[model samples]
Target: MGWFYSIDIIEGWLPATIWALVAIAMVVLLVAQRKSLKRAGLQIGIGLLSGALGLLATWLVSNVFVVFGVSLGWPVIFAVAAGFALLGFAISAAVMTHTWRRVVAIVLIPLALLATTMRVNAIYGEYQTVGSLFDYSPYPHISTLNLSLNTISVKDWNEQVKVKSRNTSNIPKSGKLVHVDIPNTASGFQAREALVWLPPAAFAKHPPRLPVMVMLAGQPGSPTRFFTASDTVKILAEFANKHHGLAPIVVSPDQNTEATRNSLCANTTKWGNAETYLTQDVPDWITENLPVSTQADEWTIGGFSQGGTCSTQLAPNHPNIYGNVLAVDGEIAPTDGSVDHMVKEYFNGSKSAYERQVPRNAIVNNAPSHQLMILGAGERDAESVSNIKKIGDTAEKNGWTVFRFTVKNWGHDWHAVNAVFKVALPYLCERMGLGNANVDFPTDSKIRELA
Candidate 1:
C-alpha cells in the first residue's frame, strides 16, 4: 500500500496513462451512445455547447468579476471546462437504452474528475508525489525536545558562529528534522506542532552556536510543508557538506490555528494574536531551548505567500529581534479579499488592523539600518513579482539592502518555492558567517541583471 501510494502525481508516465485512458473512455462512450447519425450529432452538440459555456463561465469568474481572487490562467480554465464537458458527456450517454452504456458512462465520471485534478495540479505545481497528497512526511516526530543538557548556556555562547571547526570527523552524514510541540507560554495563540531542522554541525560533540531562520508556511499549509513542499533541508545540507557542516538552524512555527484559517498574522478580536505568538512566544521558546545565536543580526524570519507576508510584517515591525527578512511571493498586504476594512476590522473587525502592518509602510517607518531583505517570486507568478517589486522598491528607497529573485519555469506553486529557496540558501549561509558559497546574487541591480 505504501508503494502504491508513493507514485508521483505531479509528473510521470502514470498520470499520462490515466489521462489517455480517460480520453479513450470518453470517445468509447460517445460512440456507444449513437443510435444513428442524428442521435450522435445531438449528443456531440450538447457536450460541445456545455464545454463552451463552462469555458465562458471560467473566464468570467477568473477575469471579469475576479473570482478566486487570482486568475486561474488558461490551463486551469481549460481543465475546469473539460470537467464540465465530461459531466455533459456522461449525462448524455446515461440516457442511452443499453445498461452497458450507462455503466460505462458512470465509470467515466470519477476518471474524468481525477484527470481534471491532475491537470490543475500539473499547472499549479502544488502536489508532487502521491505521499504528499496523503500528508505523509519523511521526518521524525517526537512529543518534546530535550535539549537542556545537550546545549550550552546563553552566557557561554561563542563569539564566532558555527562551522568554525575545520575538522568534519564528528559531523553527522545528514541533518535532523524533528517535529515537536512548542509551548505557547506568552501569546497563548493556538497553533499546530512546530518543525525544527538541526544541521549536521549541531550533532557534533562540541557544536558551536548557529544562526537561526524562523520559517512560516503559507495558508492552506502547515509547518511540515516547509519540509515536504520546499527544498530547505536538502539545500541546507548541500551547503553544509561543502562548508564543513555549517548551516543555520531552521524552525517552522505555525501561526494559524487551522490549516485553511487565516489569522492575518496580527492580534485582533476575531482571530488569535498570531503576531504575539511569532514575536514573543516563538522567539522566547527558541532562546530557551535551541543552542543558537541570540543576536538580532544572526536571526532571520522568512515565509512563502501568506507566510511571506507574515515575515515582512514581523521582521520590520520588530527589527530589534529579526535583522534579516526573506519574503517569497508574499502578499502586498495582509488581506482576505479586495477591500481591506482597516477602521472596521479587527481593531474594529478584521485581523490586519491598519497601514502600519503593511510592508510598504513598515519598511519606511522602522528604517532598519543595513538590514538585508530578499524579495522573490516565480517568473510566471506575475502577481508576486509585482508585489515584491513594489515592496522592494520601498525598501531600496529607505536605504534597506534588498535583493529580488524570480524562480524559473514555475508559478504560484511548490516548485517555485523550492527553486527560490535553493538559490537563497547559499546566500543566506554566507550571510550567517558560514564559509562563502561564491554566490553572487546581483546586489545593487535588478534580478534580471544577475549573471
Candidate 2:
C-alpha cells in the first residue's frame, strides 16, 4: 500500500500513460461518431458552451461570490474550464445510438474527469504522490521538545561561524524528519505539531553549528507538506551531499492551528498570537533545544502562499529575529476577509492598525538593515508576481539586498515553492557561512528540474 501510494502522479510514466490512454479514448470515440456528424457537431458545441460556462462560474466564484476569496487566476480558471469542456464532450459523446459507442464514451467520462484532475493538479503541483494527495503521516507526532538537545548559547553566535571542512565519513546520507511540538508558552497560540528536518551533519559524532530556518506552510496546509508535497527534504539533502551535510536545520512551525484557519500571522484577538509564536516562542525554543546558530543573520523566515505573506510581514517587522526572507507566491497583504472586514475583525476596526501589518508597510517602516529578501512567485500566478514585485521594490528602497525571480510555467503551488527554495538554498547556505555558494538554478542539472 505504501508503495502504491508512492506512485508519482505529476510527471512520471504513470500520468503519462494515463494521459495517453485518455487521448486515445477520445480519438476513438470521435472517429466512431464520424458518421453521426450532427451528433459530433453537437458534442463539440456543448463542449465549447460548457467551457464558456466554466469560465463564467469560475469568474463568479473568484470575483462575485468570493468562494476562494482571491482570484484563482487565469491558469487555474482555464484549467477548470478545460475540465468542464472535457466532461461536456465525454457526456455528449456517450448519448449516442450505438450501444458499444455509448459504453466506450461512458467509460471515457470517468477517464476524462481523472485526466482533467491530473491537469489541474499539474497546474497546482500540490499532490505529487497519492500519499501526499491524501496526506498520509509517516512519522510519529510528539507534543514535546527533546530534552537532551545540544544547546547553543546566544552570545556565542555574534560572529559568523563558518562550517569548516571536516570529515563527513560518519555523517548520514540524508536528513531526519522529526515531528515535535513547540510549546507556545509566551504567545498562547494553539499551534499544531511542528516539523524539524535535521541534516546529516546534525547526527554527526561532533556536529558543527548550523543555521536554522523557521519555515511555515501555507494557510491551508501543515508542516508535513514540506516533505509530502514539496520534497524539500530530498532537495536539502542533495545540497547537503555536496557541502558535507551542512544545510540549515529547517523547522516548520505551525502558523495556523487548523488547515482552514487563517491566523494572518499577527498578534491579534481575531486569530491567534501567530507573530508572537513565530518570533519569540519558536525562536526561543530553537535556541535552547537545537544545535543551531543563535545569530539572527543565520536565521531564515520563509513560507508559501499565506505563509509567504507571513514571512514578508514578520521578517522585517522582527528583523532582529530573521535576517533572511524567502516568500513564494505570497499575497500582497494577509487578509482573512475583505479589507474593511479584516480591519474590523483582526485590527479592532482600526484601518491604520491593519495598514501597519501589510508586508510592504513593514519593509518600508523597517530601518536600513543587512537583510536578504528573496521575493519569488510563479509566472502564471500574475497576482502574486505583481505582489512580490511590489514588496521587492519596498525592500530594495529600504536598503535590503533583494534577489527576485519567477519560475516560468509554474503557478501558485508547491511546485513554485520547491523551485524557489531549492534554487535559493545554495546562496542562503553561503550567506550563513556554510562556504562555497553554488548558484544551482539553471546551471545545475538537478536544480534545473525545478524550473
Candidate 3:
C-alpha cells in the first residue's frame, strides 16, 4: 500500500478519506498480529532499515526532480510519513521483546507524536503573516545638535593598531607610506592616513598615478579600526593587487569626535562636520602627498554598517569624486527626530535643513551617474533585510543600477556583511571598470542555504 501511494500520489494524490482508511487498517493489522510479530526481532530490524532506505530514496528522487525543475507533489509527502511510521513500528516491536519494553514504548511513542505535532505546527505557522520587524513604536530620539562636548575620553583608549606593509619585491615600488597626521578643518578636525603600494615598475619606467579607494569605518570608531581588524586590511590589499597594476591606493581617515557618539559621516554641528572632513579635507591631503588619479571613476567608497550609510550619502552628494558605494545594514531613516536634531544643532537651529541630507530623500530625487550601489542584509536580520529591500526598490524605481542580496538565515552582524563582500567587491570593480562582470564567491563561504 505504501509503495502504491508513493508512486500514484504524485498525480491524483489520495483524498483524506483514503488516508484515514489506510491508517485505520494499518493499526488494526498491527494489533491483530501483535502476538505473532512478538518473536520477529530480525523482521522488525529489517523493516526499520528498509523504511529508512526508502525515505532516503524518496528524498533523493524528489531532489533529482527539483534539480530538473519538476514537482513530485504528495508522493513525497506520503513517502516521508510512511518512512517514519515504519521506523516507529519497527523500533516499538524490537523494544517490546524486553522486560521493560512497555515502559520504553510508552515514553518513545509520546515523543514521536510530539515531534510530529511540532513539525505540523511549524509548517502552519509559516503561513501567518506578520508586520514589519523594524517598526519601533516609540521611535529612538535623534540628536541634531548638542550643547556640550564634555564627555571624558577613556584614558586607556589607544588608537587602533596599524598593519605593516608587505614587501612587494616582485612588483616595482613607486611610492611609500607618508606621515599620518590630523588636519584642522571648518568642522571639528580630520585625520589623514595613506598607503602607497606602488609597484617598482612604475618608478623604473614611466611614473603613472594610481586609482584610489577611500575606505570609511562605521560609527563607534576611527579609520584605524580597519587596521585593527586585520581581515579587512588583507581583503583590501588583495583587491588592490588584482586588476593589473591598477589597484587603488587606500585612504583611511579619522572622523571620530566628542559631540556625537559616532559620526554618521555627515557634516553636522553635533559631530563637527564629517562630510567636509572626508569629502574636502581628506582628498586635498591625499592629492598633496600621494600620486593618486584625479578621475572620479578611479575612486570607490565602501564601508559596513554606519560607514555604509556614510558612503551612500557622500558618493551621491559628491558624484564627481566617488563612483562606488557599498552599504551593509545602514540606518536610513531619521529614527524619531534625533538625526534631524543632530543636523539642526550642527547648522545652528535649522531643523528643516536636515531633510536634504538624508540618504532616502537624496537618492530618490537625484540618483548619481556612474554609481555602483551594493546593499546586503541577512534573512534572519528582519530589520536590516526590510531596510535593504526598501533601498533596492528605491534604486530600481529611480532607474539606478544596484546589486542587492539577502543571505539566508544570517543576522544583523559583521559575519553576514563580510560574506557579502565577495559579491560586493567584484560588483564595485565592475562599476569602476576595473574587472569583468563575474561574481566572486568567498573562500570560506560562511552563509548557509535555507530549506
By TM-score, the best candidate is 1
Better of 1 and 2 by TM-score: 1
Task: Indicate whether candidate 1 or candidate 3 has the larger lDDT.
Answer: 1
- Clashing residue pairs in candidate 2 (N, C-alpha, C atoms within 3 angstroms): none
Question: Where does model 1 exceed 4 Å of error?
Answer: 1-5, 30-41, 134-138, 142-167, 338-343, 349-353, 449-451
lDDT of candidate 3 at residue 185, scale 0 to 100: 55
- Candidate 2 structure quality by residue, lDDT tens digits, 38-100: 988898899899999998998788667857655666777888898788888888888754678
For candidate 1, write residues 1-451 as lDDT tens digits: 6776678886788789888888888778767655576766776677788889999999899877865545666667888998888877767766753678677778877887888888888777666678778667666764343343255432233322354444336457888899878877878889888989988767656565788999988888888777777667888888878766668989999988888888778886657788899999988888876668888878999998889999888888898889888888788888765444543655574433567788888887888457778878877667888987898888888877888888765656666677767777777767776646578667573865111
lDDT of 2 at 434: 75
Give the candidate order by descending TM-score.
1, 2, 3
Runs of candidate 2 with Cα error greater than 4 angstroms are 31-35, 55-74, 98-100, 140-168, 437-451
Superior candidate under lDDT, 1 versus 2 = 2
Q: For residues 175-267, what per-residue lDDT tens digits would candidate 3 score against the true structure?
A: 222225546554456443432333222221222355566765555544544333214445545665564333455666665553135655666
- Tell me the RMSD of model 2 versus the true structure: 4.7
